[model samples]
Target: MGNEETPESRERTDRTGWRGLLVDVTPLRTSPSFAKLWTGTSVAQIGAQITIVAVGLHVYDLTGSTLAVAFVALWALGPMILAGFVGGALADMFDRRTVALVTATVAWLSIGTMTLIAFLNVTQTWPYYVLAAINAASATILGATRGAILPRLLPTQLLPAAAALSGITMGLAITVGPAVAGVLVATVGFPWTYLLDAVLFAGAFLGILSLPPMTPEGGSASPGFSSVVESMRFLRNAPNVRATFIFDLIAMIFGTPRVVFPAAGALILGGGPVTVGVLTASFAAGALLSSLVSGPLGRVRRQGRAVTLAIAVFGLFTALFGVVLLVTGMMVGSAGPEGVNVPAVVLAGIALAGTGAADNVSAVFRTTILQAAAPDDVRGRMQGLFYVVVAGGPRIGDLLAGAVATAIALWAPALIGGLIIVALMLVLLRIARGFQHYDAFMPTP
Candidate 1:
């Protein structure tokens, strides 16, 4: 205890024995404010998921096309990317708490508007696109700001633990939200479901309001085009950070299989909206279980290796999902009442849950890298860039999955994407020994 112990070193020592795997994070979970933020975010996220399912269901009902449902995400991607970068930069220039509060208010208002439109029987596709895009864009901004704010609230060593906790929140939101949404949409109708989200969004506002004013780590930079360019230059010089972003982009771009969900729900799995909910929730369920048992993650020192390995595992699980789907297709033969089977759906859900768990582990490490390594003054801009990569990459994956599924089969995209991810990660790991050996105890410049 008297020795010169850094956070990373202490964490490593805490994991030295078999019992190290059971290292308690309770001692590190001291920040009441962070706990409050976590709680608020968790609640709001559940509501958000409910709205997402409702919106997709509403769009598909109106248009009767999988592409139309996919377009809702595609329309939002560009604006969301731009807003994330701008929001991140603004977070560096102003009070993060205030920024979050204002943006969250806008988000809630957008949802309220959507609810009104739905209630009025305006079931047109355009309104859904417009409102969904606005909501997505606002969410992008909120995500970046929130990412930047976390490092300020917790100790560096606790970052992994915090990430695990955040994963739990995400897991809970996704698991509960979509499942509940499926029930509500099937029973209560769409307007009430969207309205409920608007109400629950107030929880997010409360969380942001409770946070202390946190200015940029360094003095505020002027908000302008030049500032953004300067941040880009900073990122160019930071090879480790660049590598982390690229790796995450590759994983998301290749690994995300969300677009195939509706097709799987209606045809392959045959449970309709309920199957979609279950499939989606399966991923969150896996993530939630992983985070609940993630005491071992807090002690890992080679974070870069951990991230790479976790992402690779995610790809493997994703591939497994594709294989499971293929097997289900083989068993069912076609989309019909007799083809509707429970065991096949359950197997696919299990595979998806595994993928979600692995992805959450990767997210924790990637987030830790961004929070710990990036300079405070430039954190917002970097976060914004990170947001763009994270958000943008998945959309690209959606497009790819949709195209491939339409062309060949729904199962082909996952099989090909997973293989590509494994190959890409292996190549990246070999080339960048620096990333693999990155020590959390010794932060890179």
Candidate 2:
């Protein structure tokens, strides 16, 4: 071979044998813009997770209700859903760099205000609700804009690898942020926690600022009701993309049991905020580990099949998590933080981590399918919808879990929801045969 290697031959070399079993770092090496964006966004996400966990704990501590904590998601749900469409349209209409910067600024301001409120000792929960809603909406928009920008920065073949790497970013954010928040909130108080988040969000500003101007390719549409309608019409014809959303909604709405973690830690598992943080981090730990070893994923041809199988495994693990909680509650009824059921916590952590890993796998494939199949002109809108499903589905789950746990038992929702997810996936496997056999080389949405 000559001293200068061809890009095509080098890519083939990157995917062979042992290298195929690890997360492909080619995207980062090939594109400096992508690297900077991923790095800054990852740092900011850790801070965002800090605020997320803190807010949930604060609400739970004040009201002592899982339902109360669930309402935090409810408060942001409407605005966030609306932002998904509006943000997508904006991304397509303007320079995505500008879109990301503006939305990131709004989100940063929201965090700063939260810090101010906490420092002022304003115990009023309404302000928290208002600010959280604003932040959520802004973040939803920012996520859509950033996602749309991904395809512009990297080659088409590298998108799957990029998605897998995102698992690492998510894993780090959720894993480290909650773990830190738990200790900080328990020791230093909420003001310091909020202040730290504000400082971290500044990194996101740098990432977005560094990006080159990225306007929609092919054509642009005005950000309006008509543009939103056009996107829905496209989705109606795009069965593959439609299926991705449906499966994700089922998995997130039913299988996600995050709402009950606060109560589980406080009452059953017995580690309080520290336990809550650890439990939450376990899920991300699974995702992080899975992403690290996701070398073979880039070579898979039937991405749809992979997505389905991964989600089914997620449901199984979610159910297992419920079983662990049930056994813990039965053995140590009404135990507090001082009790600390070590074995039960370990088992639950493993199960939640399993769910996280499986979910991340499905996310990687689903995102690739959406990015590869959708037309460039409408990619932002599609990504916007994806954000809503990815983000909003959990909020809906929080409502379901909170209500079900309050009405039935703490473990009932996960058990019932997990079973429901598995059954639905089976049904979907039969009906969505096209999706089940989706060819990566010949992507169709």
lDDT of 1 at 138: 90
Residue 155 of model 1, lDDT score: 67
Those runs of model 1 whose alpha carbons end farther than 4 Å from true positions after fitting are: 1-28, 60-68, 120-125, 262-274, 327-337, 341-343, 406-408
User: What tens-digit string does per-residue lDDT give for candidate 2 at 1-445?
Assistant: 1113338426844576777788888778877788888989889999999999899988777778887887898898889989998999998888899999999999999999999988898877888889999999999999899888887787666778889999999889877887789889999999899999999998898788889988788889765799999899999999999989989999989987888998999888988877786788788899999999887888788999889889999999999999988888887765443678888899999998999899999999999999888877788899899888877888778889989999998998888899888888888778888999999878877
lDDT of 1 by residue, 273-379 (tens): 77877888788888988888787887789999998888888888888888877887776676443545788788888888999889888888888888888888888
Cα RMSDs, all models: 3.6, 3.8
Query: What Cα-based lDDT does every candidate model obtain?
Result: 0.82, 0.87
Once fitted onto the true fold, the runs of candidate 2 whose alpha carbons sit more than 4 angstroms away are: 1-13, 16-18, 56-71, 117-124, 185-191, 262-275, 326-339, 403-408
TM-scores for candidates 1 onward, in order: 0.88, 0.89
Alpha-carbon error at 338 in model 1, in Å? 3.9
